[model samples]
Target: MWIVLMAESYDRLKKRAQNRRSDAEEAAKYIFDIPEDMLSDLSDDDDDNDPDFLSPEDLDDVDANTEPSDDYSVETPPSSHQQQPEPTASTGKSKKKLKVQEKFGWRKVEIKKVDLSWKGEPRQVPGILETPLKYFQKFFDDELLELIVEQSNLFALQTEGCNLCLTVEELKVFMSIILLLGVIKVPYYRMHWEAATRYPKISDKMGRQRFAKIKRFLHFNDNSKAKKSGEQGFDKLYKIRPVLGHIRSKFLEVTPEENHSIDEQMILSRGEAA
Candidate 1:
């Protein structure tokens, strides 16, 4: 247990082993580089009393503060007369920080994050969600539009608030004129659409509340299971989305003779995850 507690981690041990191997190789290279003359100069026959060697009297100042060693190797303490000057506060701190940086060898790196914030321009790349909505103009067929109006009017009558009590035929006429107003602009606002139809202008002529009611309650697919099972994500699109999946499946089933390019798109928004 004690040995296990004191044992170094695998990474530390591997690093230490690599360092030892590198140091040994470096020392071997240095030893091989040494000339024969330098090795021969270190003879054991040299006398301590030789005039060329340093005498005890000459080392009296150095040895005064240090104890005499048993071996021939001399260990001299730093001399009091040759003491280094005390470093200033600023200089000491700078020198210490520099030394720490060099020893650890860590570089300060700055990483800039991707700016996903929509700029409403070419600045940020645009996707299907971010681009101008062109669904109404692109896939709005007469049959689909008529069915949407019929179903929406039925839902509006059943809904508690923002109800549009118009019949299927009246709603069809209303939707047709309203859609035409997109292409042919008129200053009459809601009355422009009402006057184009045979319906009387006695009631509210397609007001904002009725418009919102149609938008909220509109459905193309059966969502009874989805509503009961608490479905989410693309399943929620079933409530308000047309039969777009069937259209996609039809296109997939057919083989194209011509080649076309399609761009990839991602929907990114507040609290919306893909």
Candidate 2:
């Protein structure tokens, strides 16, 4: 009886061992049969605690997919902090008001009408006989007239400020040359030699060289003259010596009535004769 009992017990123990082995083999087979994607997902979950496991691309994708919370507010860029003001009808009116205020200022001028017609020659008049105020009122607005007056006054002040260091003879020679050039209406190269020969102060060689320098200062080259002619012929017409003389006579305190008369003659000769 004891021997039979031992054999049964041994058999039972062997069967239990075999069953445990079979169960272990079945579980391993099931695990191996799982899809590669499921296995990868399980491996990723296992590596969640590891900081080095996630790649930069993976982290970027995660950040991109995540949405901001409702409670969180993003800070605006410095450039976008200020809001732009919109243009409106009220603003337009304000701009017009500002322009008017800028033009007239607080003080106003009282203008009176006067007849200026005379039987005498206009050239003999002491001052500009025509009422500049009336002319301005007719041709332009008060604002425009104010601007013109301001600019003219400024130009007068500037011209009067220059000190001419030339001797009386040199001044006479310069004026005579300018007048001759105006009368003949010839280019500087042709007239310069003749003028220099006529005037004892100017040598022929010096006159020629000075002519080139003066032309350069006046921007009388082909290209600049052509460009200026296309616009208004301003460059060709604005000779520096004549302009300086006029400005000096009109604005300078040292200039007498004789100088003014000479300037008037020069103006007439250039404008009417030339």
Candidate 3:
């Protein structure tokens, strides 16, 4: 009876174990079978018709054996939803520099008499009396003399009057002096001295002051005109004045021998007279 009982118990345990094994297998099949169909559907969606589809075989050329390289990169194309930047406008316009105008005038003056015998005389003919004659004779046939006269007149008009006021004849004389200096490329003071020496009637101090005033007026007028014309106003006006002053000083310093000659001649004449 005991042996039979033991055999019955063993049979029950084996049967229970077999039942558990069968349940586990069924559960595994239930889980795996559903995923298999889902996998198949995913594979079908990865065909050429799908723009985002890419196969593992396609990526096989990307060396699996080697470490990945960041040197070369793949970027997604810019989408229609993305915004781009616009260009800016240009502004670099330039203005032209102006040309300085010629300013001076001339007129024909009748000679009352010709002193032919005075040519070889110790008392030389004054430059005032000689210059026009020489110019008229040299450029008589050419238009140069007429042009000179016109320019002189224009200059007189441009710079007329004492800093206070100027008469027409005084203005003409001022213009003539400016032209003479310019032609010879001399300074205002030197030109003033020349004119004073030529015409003993003109006082030295008066001529000097006149030239200084004229220079200041010209400089101020030029700057004002440029400003009024909507041009680049004289940015260098202050600097230019100092430079012009230095130039004037240097010019006066030049030709020391010629400058001293007149003084030396006067001194020697005085000594001889004494």
Candidate 4:
């Protein structure tokens, strides 16, 4: 009787152990066998807050059964954050749908070539392309030089209470020295007149002191008659207005060929060019 009772207890224990193991295995299978839609929802919930994360729709998954069309086409999916445009009543189509349906059609057309030959005169004013000085003087004539002299002398008298008596010939020499300095650059204007680095062409034509005085008193327009800054009739380039006007008049007189181009690279410095 004792042996039978012990065997019955042993069998009950074994049965309980098998039942617990079976329950555990079934629970594990239930966890792994979740529905596809439920798994997708869980994944979307996890990534909804993440902006950088791409949703399933953004991915291009071509169907294996689909065949290629004769016309090449690509449809890009809109971002998750982008709002959908409302459909218009007249067209019965949304702007996005219209954009997707838009096609670029090409058709055969006839084109004609036109002649582009020069018919105008070779030279507007027939004259020899002579010396450089003559070419320069053609633009900066005696009239322009006289105007400079008059203005400079008048400015000197007004400011210094003394006659500058600036002649056109002297003004021309002063201008020549200025142009020469641009070509043969030095650290300072005084260096050109210095004994160690004396340029005779500049120093011999005009003394350093005289050049400085002329430069100081030089004017293109009357200061008293000019409007001040913030005034009603103020001109930004008032001081150089007369000079600019004269130069512009001269520029208007010039006639170029049909294919003429003005190269402005020469005026720009290295810093400006960059």
Tell me the lDDT of model 4 at 48: 63
Error of 1 at 41 (Å): 27
Total backbone collisions for each predicted model: 0, 0, 11, 0
Model 3, residue 97: distance off in Å is 25
lDDT of 4 by residue, 1-274 (tens): 9788667866765676677643333333343555555454454455668887764455444454458896998889976456667454445553333343333567898878878788876866557667989888878899888888889898998888989888999999999999999999989988999999999999999999999989888888888899888999999888888888888899888775777776666655668444
Sort order, TM-score high to low: 4, 1, 3, 2
Candidate 3 ranges with C-alpha deviation above 4 Å: 1-70, 73-163, 191-206, 218-274
TM-score of 2: 0.19
lDDT of each: 0.52, 0.46, 0.48, 0.78
lDDT of 2 by residue, 176-216 (tens): 45555666554443544664435333443246554443333
- The sequence of per-residue lDDT tens digits that candidate 1 reaches over residues 224-250 is 334544535446466655657545654
How much does candidate 1 score in TM-score? 0.29
Task: Sort by lDDT, best first.
Answer: 4, 1, 3, 2
Clashing pairs in 1: none
Candidate 2 Cα misplacement greater than 4 A, ranges: 1-172, 191-206, 218-274
Whose lDDT is greatest here? 4
Residue 236 displacement in candidate 4 (angstroms): 1.0
Better of 2 and 3 by lDDT: 3
Task: Report clash pairs, candidate 2.
Answer: none
Per-prediction CA RMSD (Å): 24.4, 26.9, 30.3, 18.6
lDDT of 2: 0.46
